[model samples]
Target: MSTATAEPAGRPEGAEDAQGAERAEGAEGTGPIRFGVVGTGWRSEFFARLARGLPDRLELAGVVTRSAERAARVRREWGVPAFLSVAELLAAEPEFVIPSVPWEVTPEVTGELVAAGVPVLAETPPAPDAAGLRALWEQVGASGLVQVAEQYPLMPGHAARIALVREGVIGTPTSVQVSSTHMYHAVSLIRHTLGVGFEPVTVTARAFTAPLADPLSPKGWSDDLTPKDARTTLALLDFGGGRSALYDFTDNQWWNPLRSRRMVIRGSLGEIVDETVVRMADPRTPYETPLVRRRTGLDLNLEGSEVRHITFDGRVVWRNDHTGAHFSEDDLAVVELLCRTGAWARGAAPEPYPLAQGCQDHLIALAVEESARTGEAVATGDEPWSA
Candidate 1:
């Protein structure tokens, strides 16, 4: 595994750095990397909130809203310039713009920015439907300036898993079972964990619905005994060479604690069940230890707390830019995405999540849904962007 760039610090993949690398963010640093957002919607708030939360590492250069009224509200809340169009947002000279609009309109917004030569860190599912996928790919696929924010694999826990898998600690990772996220995001983790690059695969899926108590959501818990039909999908992706993945997810799987968020990685020597790893310590020795997370500012501490890093057996596998800052794993992942994008735009790092990878993830995800709907195996066909 190569070192994937993280921010304020570069997070190289695989175990600890040979040089005993430590976080190098100065006790102080420059103003955060300046970037802009193109929408004022819910998804776009992550970008704005990240910049606002990490003042030392990011700066919200400007925002492109749909109307002057929304722009005014945004300006008051974020204390940053807000524009009604991309042209106006470009005037501030941001390093890039994230087209965080609806899936239906994302292509147009992204195409507009790409035409203007403004780099983009696009939102997920770059396009909504198959036609849109092909059209969007042909339009900006060759631009080399767009990187999608497929941040799941970069999430702290997943990053630790990948880093450990890369070191052969599990001995040739063979299979992955992901129930944490849906389709594309799940496929991303499966392919990454198996070390399979944009490879073709056969997918068989089935969908079943059952009457279950409606679980609580951010919107609020449902009234007790209110039964809602819940869809459960199970998908099998065979990548050949006996490398495969099983994706199990229920509707709103992300929010359903009753479903039990989990991952199982099987290897030649053993397997990993969530935080615990049962693998060979040596030829004759078997060892297991829970992945330990070191955090700061617990309980009665006034210094504030944040996830520091995850480790297995005392060896740090993944560390963040802000070691003690207030951030959840997902928050840290998104911050790293923005920072890495800024670095890529400035030629300080490689494209973080390339266009091809994002396209492939979505294409596979589509196959999952199709397979589930038709009650048959779906062969993942080559798309225009298949490399």
Candidate 2:
């Protein structure tokens, strides 16, 4: 994985250097990259909030909402021009546009934007189903203007682990177990940790259901504490050549307070379990260390409450560039995706997360679901984007 331009100090070894990278920021020397939003839903607001929070790096030029009332509310709340159509949003001349609409509508909107020759940072699972994914790929896969907003790899903990894996701290990752986010997001993490690309996978999965108390959601906590039956899906993805990933996910794990995210990346020399790493440092002895995070605003630190950097065995693996903004782990990941997308759009860096990669992630995720539903293994062969 190539590092983006304008990376902070303490980047891992073998990562790309920012010094020789081109500076093609549109009309502004190192100024914020201008972008537009094409929805008024919960996820779309993430982009708007990021633009407002990091004014020095991002600027929201306009937005496109479905209704006049929603457009008016967005304009009043976000203080950006809200339009009714993508064409009107394009008139703002944003360098790129983000489509955060529903699953079924995403590919259509993305195709429309691609037809206009505009760069797009689409939301996760660019299409709803396998057929939709195939159709969307046939339409826009050839166009290099589409990049998916797959930000899980950009999360601080995952970023740190990916760095260590790339630095050979774990020596050729063989398998990964992810009990974190669902579907494509987890697959993305698995691929990054294992360093596999476009490999065919055979997935075997099963789902179990149990009653659990779930009072939290995207809308916040509810008064009802009733226990509801929740489904947990477990999958084994065999990526061939002794590479595999274990995928585990529960319903509403993203916002449930009771469930915690966990990961284990196993390699020949060592393995990383959550934050702790156990590896052979020398032929005679084994070394165990924790990935420590430098978080400010603990007791007497005046630097505010935010993660500064992550260190493993006295070396910085990941450093936060937007430290003072006080973002959560997910927020940090999304912001990093936005920054990298900006660089890629301006030709300063490689495409952050291309369409094919996103397509593959979703294709595998869909296979996981199919295997779970059918109680049989599903083999995901090459698709149009596999090339």
Candidate 3:
């Protein structure tokens, strides 16, 4: 294996200048944590963009893409070395490698990296299906070098809610209603807020078809002016012990403006619906408050329209650690995962998200799909990783 150092050749086009780069890189005084990526796909670019945004905390050491044309594009666009193999990428000595390839390819690449004794932060799902998940778990589940990049719980809004729930502000959470993202992402959020571990869940789901305007998607706004039939799947997850979750998802909900992202966490003493918190302060008194966000650059105060922190009951529940980075809420979560993975890889912090958690999340998600199709309830039993 090649052990040659792969360093940045020069600053890429549109990158910040020397003084600005230095200022951002030196902000934390520990230098940027260098990491490598093993794919150059669309999802991988999110990592590259976040590294550029949060220069003080992250640095892209190299990228591995099989296609020479894509590799050249990555080198030109990212201003980082592009290699053809994991061995070459590891030669750069990145603290960890993010396998952001396709779902089917993720487990194989992750196994390769783990076998090489390098820490890895794998993309979501980790495998394509249940069998794939089991096989992948059998391969690298006990390596203790794998962390999945599950960023949903790390988002500022969700993080704040989770903090409140953990602090007994909501008593013991009994159920959660998630209408935001879908599949494993939705499952991750539900499991996280309810604080449920590998407990077996009985999922009852069904699909409904309805007409809705399809204006927006991940690509962009569609010019076709027509209302199309959209699929909406709703499921009830029973975690036993009187804990449950209601999973609701509509097609294109992530980008469609008509369907807003929503969540509800119900506890013994109170419940949280989106940004509003309603709880019983005492035996007969009820309290209500909005989780206000300190966003800058609204009218005249020019801090540049970024989220500063989230507050509840006059106390800060979630603070933007990358305040000056000008990142969106989703970007904030991704960048936080990258930094936390880097810290764990270097033994400076605990594992951010373990592979077993991802496996369980996906397993439950698959059951959701199955129950929706078969029109019957599905139960997920213990898996190898569930232990």
Choose the strongest candidate by TM-score.
Answer: 2
The segments of candidate 3 whose C-alpha lies over 4 angstroms from its true place after superposition are 1-29
Output the TM-score of candidate 2.
0.93
Q: Count clashing residue pairs per candidate.
A: 1, 0, 0
Candidate 2: deviation at residue 208, Å?
A: 0.4
Which digits, one per residue and each the tens of the lDDT, describe model 2 over residues 113-151?
A: 989888889998999999999999999887778889998
Candidate 1: clashing pairs of residues: 3-12
The sequence of per-residue lDDT tens digits that candidate 1 reaches over residues 1-387 is 112522111222431221112211211224567898888887777778777788877888898888888889988987889998889889998877898888898889889988987778888888887788889999998777677888888887788787778777788899999989997789888877887766678999999999766567767776565768999999999988999999999888777656778999999878888888898767899888898887778888666788777778888778766654588888888888887777666655556777667777888889889999998888876777665
Ranking by TM-score: 2, 3, 1
- Show where candidate 1 strays beyond 4 Å: 1-31, 221-225
Q: What TM-score would every model get versus the actual structure?
A: 0.90, 0.93, 0.92
Candidate 2 lDDT (Cα, whole model)? 0.85
Model 3: residue 106 alpha-carbon error in angstroms: 0.6
lDDT of 3 at 164: 84
| Candidate 3 structure quality by residue, lDDT tens digits, 79-110 | 88999999999999887899989999999999
Candidate 2: residue 64 Cα off by (Å): 0.2
